[model samples]
Target: MLHLRAICPAERTDAVLAALKAEPGVTHVVLLRGAAVDPVGDVVEADVAREATDQVVASLCDLGVDRDGGVTLEQIDTALSDAADRAEEAAPGDGADAVVWEELLARTGEESRLNATFLSFLTIACLLTAVAVVTDSPVTLVGAMVVGPEFGPLAAISVGLVLRRWDLVRRAALALAAGFPVAMLITAVGTWLGSRTGLFDPDLALAGHELDFVFEVGPFSLIVALLAGAAGMLSMTSAKSAALVGVFISVTTVPAAGYAAVAAVLGQWDICLQSIAQLAVNLVGVVVAAALVLALRNRRGQVRDLGRPLGNG
Candidate 1:
């Protein structure tokens, strides 16, 4: 179930209440007249079935409650009322199977921003991967994968593509285009500096390392990338946080960037190229597969791009 709160302008309150009452997925409706101070409106609240969030939200937006007023949706952990149960039953689909698009849009938008935290996390993941390569630490390599923030932007790009929001696609693309290079460049510099300081041995790149798999680009790598992308997107749409971590651990995107940076620092041009290829393959594979998943998920109105586009065209 979901808790919905809409602060409606005095004139829109009746229309908002009518819409809420008309939704079979909605229950526990309450109206607090002139309750809003900042927005200066009446507060209308309701409990809605999770699976019907999109429908209920759309109804409110159509009544202009979202613009002239404010609408907020929140997850409901425990709705013990009988009406809540009826609302859930009245909903057309399972909650877990539903895609709350507004939540996803907001999430991906924030994630796609090329901000300090995103840069720091990516750089740190790469540095971790570099260390894992030098030391052949499987644990560190896995840790690097988990720490990577790249998936967020990648998911953003996929979502944007599916919705045909070119501005979203461009913003997300900016993050990827800028973030990876910045991370790789910093990791390369750090590796070189560490070598000079005796923190790492430059010759380690030439040595046989089990972590070399991080740099190997093969057909299997693409297959794994595709599978990871699908699983990642499914998890995101389903709002399963735990499943997302598994996706992170399954991909080598972060480790590949780290391997490339370390190889470049060691002047192992061939290995650097190989790692770069691996990185590219993984990224392309994930995005392509994720976009496909989103396109298919949009079938039967499971997901809809209803809001105004950020793009001009």
Candidate 2:
């Protein structure tokens, strides 16, 4: 279940209440008049089912209260009243059980873009990954994966496709297409400097090292990417953000890019190409899997919305 908060003038309270009461899954409504001090007005709270949240929000939006007033929805963990219990019962089971494409898209729409702080982290992570690849340190590679911010754009792309939001798709693609090339160029310069300073030796490569797992692309990599993509989407839609960290570690985009940078420094075109190929394979697998999942989820939602009487019409 979800709790919706709305603030509007006391005069407008009746209209807003009527609209909220008419919503499909709204189980409880509370009105507190002229309660706030700063920009004081009335507060209307509604308890609604999770599956019906999107429609309820849409209805409120159509009423123009979202602009004239403020509206917010938060997931409710426990219910203290009968209305709340009904709302809970109306909720879809275990938000993680299946993807809800429209809900996912709506949730993603709320995500903020990569700001300066995030970009700075990405820079530091890329540099560390580059250094790790040159030194062949598995520990540093993992650290880089933990620090990288590339997953946001990738997730945005998947959500964009599901929502059919071309602007989002273009923005995400631009971020990914531009981000890696810039990171690679910067890493290449760093590697060249390190080679001259004896901190890195181009003659020494980790191709024979047991930890050299960057270039071996196979079915396992595809499976990992697919699973990671699904998990990532689930994390985005649900409240389980901690799981996204694990998803990041499972994917190989950052490590592969780091490997490619090191291969470029060593002047090993073959290894560089191989690393690039591995990254490509993982990326393609994740995007394709995410798109398919979204498509299936959207189809199911449409059927459910139509209320087709559960059997042959």
Candidate 3:
């Protein structure tokens, strides 16, 4: 369920109330009038079901509430009201079952653009990976992977596919295609310079390393990426950004990129190709897994909508 706070002039309160009353899944309407010192209007507070939030918000907007004063709706993440609990008791599935493709797309935010934070994250990931390779530490390599912020855009691409947002899809694809190569190139140059300074010795290259954990692509890596992608999507949709740290560690993208750079610096062409392949496999696995999760969740949402006459459509 969602809680909405709408501020409008007292005179227009009737229109706003009328609009809210007409909308489905809107209940517990409370009006607090003449609260503002500037006396712009009254404030209307209400609880709305998650399924009906979009329509209710749209209805409020149509009533010119936004222009006259303003309407703000925030999702209530706490315990539900008695009425909502009763409704949920009557319903089989939780609100998450009603997460439609559109809702997911909205949660995805602006995928058509790359923000500074994302770019900075990529840069840091690349830099960290270079440092890890030069130091020949698997721990540092994993640290670099966990620090990378490329997963958001990757998840955005999957959300785009499930929602059929071609703009999102194209932007995500472009970001991935462009971002990885650029990062790899930068890491490669950094690795080369590190080699020249005797910071990274050719003997420590991962190419002929016997450790099964260091340079091999296996089922374990695929599983890790799949899990990481799922967790990433959950974190993104819930807006719990802190979980991304664990996700970065769960995937091998940064480690593989680092390995590729290290191989390039040592002039090990075969190992470089193998590392690149590992990175590609992990990327594909994460995206595909995320897409499948979104698709299934969307299908469940459709089913729930069919069962309820909430006028959400």
Candidate 4:
């Protein structure tokens, strides 16, 4: 279940209440008239089923509650009310399958920014992968995968394409374009430093290692990427996010890029090209798969919203 709180303008309070009362998924509606001070409006609150969160939120936004005042949503860990159970049963879809696009757009906007922190994390993740490659350690590679922050922008790009948000698509594309090269360059420098310090041996890097599959770009790689991307989008939109870590582990984007950087610094042209291909394959596969999943869910959400009224101008 989800709890929603809205500060509505005096004139829109009645419309907000009517919208909530009309939705079968909403219950326990509370209206405190003239309770808002800063926003100078009424305080309205309601409990809604998770499956119906998108519709209810869309309804509130349609009434211009968000523009005139504010709307806040929080998950309810424990709602012991029988009314909450009844509401959930009345909602059309399963809660776990619900897609709240507004929340997703907000989250991806924050995550996909091309800021110092994002660049730093990308650099660090690639560096870790470089170390893993030189040492031929699967554990280190997995650690690098866990630390990589590239998935945010990739997912954002997919969502942007589905929603036709050109700004978001451009922002995410710019972040990836700038961030990856910078990260790879830093990783190359680290590789040179490590080799100079006797920490990384070029012979060990060139020799076949147990983790060689990280460098292989093939149909299998694309299949793995597609699966990971689907799982990733599901984890993002659904209530359970625990599966996200598995998606991170299943992808080879960071490791492949790291290998490419290290191979380039060591003057191994063949390995460099192969690693680059691996990185490209994984990235393209994920983007295509995620876009499809989001597009399908978006269609369903739109179908559900067909008769909804537009927000006040």
1-313: candidate 3 lDDT, tens digit per residue: 6778888888889988998777656777898888745537898998876666656666776677766776666767775478766544543444554453334554454543465666666767877876766565667667777778777678878877876667677777777777777777887887778778877676765533332253577888788788888877766555365887888787878677767876787887777788887788788888988888777666433522211111111
Q: Model 2 lDDT vs. the true structure?
A: 0.71
Best by TM-score: 1
Per-prediction CA RMSD (Å)? 2.3, 6.6, 6.1, 3.4
Candidate 1 wrongly placed segments (more than 4 Å): 300-305, 309-313
True lDDT of residue 117, candidate 1? 91
Against the reference, the lDDT scores of all candidates come to 0.87, 0.71, 0.69, 0.87
* Candidate 1 lDDT by residue in tens digits, 1-313: 8899999899989888889888898999999999999889999999988788888898888888877888888888877899899988998889888888887777788888888999999999999988888787899999999999999999999998988777788888998899989999999998888889998676764488678787788999999999999999988888576798999998899888888888888989898999989999999999999989888878776555455654221
Q: What is the lDDT for 154 in model 4? A: 89
Q: lDDT score, residue 92, model 4?
A: 89
lDDT of 1 at 293: 88
Better of 1 and 2 by lDDT: 1
Q: How displaced is residue 81 in candidate 1, in Å?
A: 2.7
**TM value for model 3:** 0.73
Q: Which of candidates 1 and 4 is the stronger one according to TM-score?
A: 1
| Per-residue alpha-carbon lDDT of candidate 2 for residues 1-313, written as tens digits (9 for 90 to 100) | 6788888777778888888777656777888988845556788898877666766666666676666777777767777887766655666554444343344554553332544655566666778877777677878878888988777777767767766676666766776677777777777788888888888666775547644677788888889989988877667666677998998788888778877887887788888898899889888777777666666566533322211111111
Error of 1 at 95 (Å): 0.9
lDDT by residue for model 4 over 171-283, one digit each (tens)? 88899899999999999999999888988678778688887898877889999999999999988989888998999999999999999999998999898899989999999
| Residue 113 local lDDT, model 4 | 85
Backbone clashes for every candidate come to 0, 0, 2, 1
